[model samples]
Target chain A: MAVYHADALVIRSREYGESDRVLTLFSREMGKIQAVAKGVRKPKSRQRAGAQLFTYGDFLIHKGKSLDTVSQCSPKESFSYLWSDLDRSLAASAMAELLDISTISGQPNAELFTLTLTCLFLLEQYETSLLLSAYALRLMVILGYRPHLGDCVECGERLQGERLFFSSEAGGTLCGRCRESYSGRMVRAGSIAFMRQLIQADLSKLDRLRWAAWMREEVLETLRHYLEHKFERPLKSWRLGNTISDGLERHIRSLNGKEGKEFE
Target chain B: MDFLNYPQPLADLISSLARLPGIGPKTAGRLAFYLLQQPQISQDLAQAILTANHSLKKCSICSNFTDQDPCALCQNPQRDSTELCVVEHPRDVVSLEKTKEFKGRYHVLHGVLSPMEGIGPEQLTINLLLKRLKGVQEVVMALNPTVEGEATALYLARLLKPLGIKVTRIAHGLPVGGDLEYADEVTIARALEGRRQL
Candidate 1:
């Protein structure tokens, strides 16, 4: 078994056997690979933090007969903020999930790997929804699944600032005429432009984009439909975020019940 | 190959033991061979497993496994009901009870919010916890500091906040007696942020 080193991100981590973790890593050198981190679940294991989900690390691995074993791992950036903040954690999980489900093993895509690390790192600083949407759109572009947002896919109709629809089936924006034949979820023209910019713009320019609540909800749903439709699998991580946030909203509604009440 | 393997009956026993968490085929084989060699030990162990499985049921109030319906903690009048400590597992309830500092009763969640593992809120005992929180002044979250555990605590906090209950999480920081140099950044940061004034 040959020993190798890779700068990797721990995307998916789960308990395996006794005191071991099976990690699906996205590395610059190895692409997406599954490795077993031995005894990391032990109380005193040094690799516990490094093996956690969304941790970016330098890993020394030994190629095994079946699975690769992580002989040594040191977390360069654990993204601890992402772990503590529920909203950010959910967003990061969705990104990780996208990378895991879409990509195959041992085929390196430096773009996707770098995008994932950037998104995870910026998840602490940026609006989580925007970061998630941007990452998803960028991921699609990188994987050659970029949606047609500039013009109608059915007909080469230039999308004007009017009644527009996004059809995941058609793989892009649909005009009013196209929508009559094929149904697409009604979305604003601005959201289409926003998504276009999100996909095309560099990662550094992400902070400049103005994100609204309406944009977040609409783009999130639209991309979710498109991504799920393309992958033919449900976005479990995205659903997890939505449902948990709904719980938070339920709490807010309860707090709003005390109208005109004195502050505690 | 057949001769190299254990006999059918022994193989069956080993396989059964291997299905258990943390027990591999090798350990299971050792355990099975030991059981077969000692008839008294095997009989006693089997009886103990069956008895524990048959008798111990989840407590009606807290959902912790117990021989009684309400469990000793829930039934104990000396324990305070106003302060409720919510934990992810029955083992967590045991750990907290060991401290003896907390006189309040506990509510076991059975598990955390792990979506990657296909666990949703529906898979947990959240509804039961909400229903049983009448007159409870505070809900203390004693969950792990992992991503799933944090999300579970946040979800529960939001779901329970509508009831006008005060919800707080347990302090998670650098472990006592552990070297500062060896502590992970997450733990150290959390400790710094949560530092108390002397």
Candidate 2:
């Protein structure tokens, strides 16, 4: 088996044997590959920490016919902060899920790889809900799913200062006149501006961008609809996030003696 | 009637054995042949599997597979109900029980929040756990120290903390009887960061 090196992100990991792990990695060179980290589940295993999810590292792997084996791995950026908080951890998991589903195996996409790393790094520093929306929106741009932010998809009319409708089916924003013929969801104008700024600006500077509750809901709603329309199924992690957050919300309301608030 | 021209019944036995965890096709065939050589042992094995399947049921309170309702751990009045330890699997509950260090009841989640596997809070026993936390003062999260474990612990903490209950995670660092030199940098750092002045 020939030994090779790759700078990779640990996208997913699960227990294999009594003391080993199977990792799905997205590397700069290899798009996505499943490799075994032998004995990494052992407490004394040196590669245990590096084999964790969202860990970015330089890995020395032995190429095998069926599945590659990780011989040596040292962390360059563990992205520990992602796991330090609940929201960030969920956001990172969602990001990993998206990356796993969107990319093809063994087909290098440098822009997508960089986008994942940047989003994971930024997830640690920004509001998780806002940052998650931004990451999803920007990811769509990289994968050639960039929505029409400029003109209405139907009549190609300029969509400014008017109530805009975003149709996942129509593939972009629709003008008031064009929306009559289509069934796109109404998107807040502020959310459109925020998304435009988010996709256009440097991710590191996104902290300075103003994010509102309405923006979070609208962005997530539109992006999720577009993703489902494009990908044919809703992202599983996104569904998991909504479930947990909804449970948390209900739990909080019950604790506050405000059961059945009836607020959507 | 495959398997190098084996009989149909023998091939079916091998195929069934191959479906078990950790058993490959070759090992399954070997095991099937071995069982054929030891008829009494094979009968005993079959009886055992049937017995286990017929008797075992998940304890409604803790969700651990047990022969009895409210399993031994849940029925034990000696265990403190006020201090509950939540774990990911029933096997985890067994491991913690072996330690004999915990004196609290357990809530087995059966799984963690693994989105890739389609496991969410609803899939786990999270709702049951939340409902069971009444009069509970503290919840000790004893999930494994993986990304999913961290997320579940934090998620539970977020939900539990708001109910005026103290949420704590089992500290993960160097293992017992482990040398500091052999421990990884991350483990050592986590250990030191979580150190208490004793």
Candidate 3:
């Protein structure tokens, strides 16, 4: 077995049996690696902290016939803060989900790993959920799933002052005239602009953008639409998030005793 | 399968570990071998696992991971009981607590409503939440800004509107540090439309 070392992100993991685990890792040097961590589930395993989901670490793996074996794992970035809050954790999950979908297994794309690490770090430092949303949208773009946010994708004209439509099929924005020819959903002009900024802005600039509450919702919705259009399957975490939000709203209404005001 | 000199217990352990999230067969085998070299490590791991398994419980009010039923946040007198932020999981409550932007209570649904997955209202903590709404004044739908999140928010809005308490959704659109010029028109428009009066 050939042994190698690399910086890796724990993309996902599944239990094999009693004491072993199969890990799907995205590494800076090797892209995506499928490895087995033997006996890490056992008590006092040294690799326990380094092998957790969302853990960034230096990993030692020995090449096996079918898969790689994780011999040594030293934690580089634990990102414990991301799990400290619900919004941050979900934001992190959304990013991880996007990375999981965008790249093919076993393909080594260092850029993607760096992007994932950068985004995770940003989520840790910033309290704003909008930053995380923007980062996820941009990850899709970096991986060639970039949605059309600028002028009409159909006509290739400037979309200024026009009611813009987002055709996930068309792969960009559509002007009013071109929008008629496309069958995709219409995205408000504001949403299109917001997405464009997310795609083009640098991390430093993204940190400075002052966001309002409604604007955050629009950005998240736009990204969700694009991701759904790309991945076909809705994210599991997103669904859970919605149910809880709904139930809470209903509970609050019942407590207030007004029971007739518009909730949406 | 080559069975000569193979330990059944070791092979079984490797296969089982391979099924875990990030572990593969090779890593599983290595870990198993490592465990064989250190029985003390295995013993400590077993104890910790048992302790965590037995000690961790959901807080009755917020549904967060805790040793106590009400949890610290639910029991805290300083928290605003009238204003509640509804989130998808316990992690969100932890995030909001750090912000200091909110001092209200929280309710975790544990999961969301997805019709395709056969998850409905009854599958969540909707009943418990409804029971807790006796004197709350506001409910903030703080779910992720995703399609499902929006659908859930809308669903809650519809349900809560009829009951007459103020229901607000966490806003969506652009990031605080994003560029105006790069922003798509749809986002800009939504930001404008959803703009609040300062």
Best-matching candidate per TM-score: 2
CAPRI docking class of candidate 2: acceptable
Ranking by TM-score: 2, 1, 3
Tens digit of per-residue lDDT, candidate 2, span A84-108: 6877787788888888888888998
Q: What is candidate 3's lDDT per residue for A76-161, written digit by digit as tens?
A: 77775643344565556666766776677768887778778987888866754666677777677777777767766766787776
Docking class of 3: incorrect
- Top DockQ prediction, candidate number: 2
Which stretches of model 3 miss by more than 4 angstroms?
A247-264, B1-198
B1-198 per-residue lDDT for model 1 (tens digits): 232387888888988888898787788888988999999999999999999999999997889999999899999999899999999889888889888889998999899887666677777887668667667889999987777888888778766676688999999776667778877665677789889999
Candidates' C-alpha lDDT? 0.84, 0.84, 0.71
Model 2 alpha-carbon miss at residue A261, Å:
18
| Reference contacts reproduced by model 1 | 0.32
A best-first ranking of the candidates according to their DockQ comes to 2, 1, 3
lDDT of 1 by residue, A170-228 (tens): 88987778877775688888888899999877777788899788888888999999999
Provide the DockQ value for model 2.
0.49
Q: What does candidate 1 score in Cα RMSD to the true structure?
A: 3.8
Which of 2 and 3 is the better model by lDDT?
A: 2
Q: So what's the TM-score on candidate 2?
A: 0.91
